[model samples]
Target: MSDASPVHFIAHFTVTDGDGYHNYEKRFFPVLKPYGAKFITFDDNVTVLEGEREAGRTVIIQFPSEKVLMEWWNSPEYRELAAIRHQATTTFSVSVIHAIPQR
Candidate 1:
């Protein structure tokens, strides 16, 4: 990661109902795209050992900067989609971290 091109560390993890994933992907994947991020990976499985076996998903996105991400998240278009995702999902983790700037 270079100083000039700010990198973002993003993680989206969750356990979901098998049926609910289609809607989420159809609706939510679009919501996360406007930030001009590189879709590094999207996984649809979460394994638990101690707890009961469950189905889950994870999405990783890499943005150029925190500012761009904030711009996308705070925009009006995403606001509506976010509301839908909140209603359709059980649990999710969405985190963004700024990459260390290079010298």
Candidate 2:
């Protein structure tokens, strides 16, 4: 499991607030400092789907561990960003999932 990847499945809904999304993305990692999400990606853009996937944008946050992932998900820091996201989008759905270690 040492070499295995850690990824969290996430989907976000944006009300489409103006300005560069980069602004938020830059600060997000730092804000998630305490809980620690190592990497965040807007995934669907890179991969193609044959049919309908989740309606909203798909993001993956690689955490230090599964426990940390849960902690971060509930952390107030994340909650703060969530508020901004909500305002930016009509709605959002966040799901926390652990990837099976690649053997």
After superposition, the stretches of candidate 2 with alpha carbons farther than 4 Å from their true spots are 1-7, 20-23, 53-56, 90-93, 101-103
Q: Per-residue lDDT of 7-93 in model 2, one digit per residue for the tens?
A: 575766553765434455656778777765666677534454576444456666777766677677678887877676666665457
For candidate 1, lDDT tens digit of each residue in 1-103?
6433655555454534445556656776576776777878766665555865335556667777777777777888777766656665655456776666567
Per-prediction TM-score, please?
A: 0.66, 0.63
- Model 1 lDDT, full chain set: 0.64
Instruction: Compare the candidates by TM-score and give the number of the best one.
Output: 1
Superposition error at 80 for model 2 (Å):
1.6
lDDT for 93 in candidate 1 is 52
For candidate 1, the per-residue lDDT at 31 reads 69
- Judged by whole-model lDDT over C-alpha atoms, candidate 2 comes out at 0.63
At residue 38, candidate 2 shows an lDDT of 60
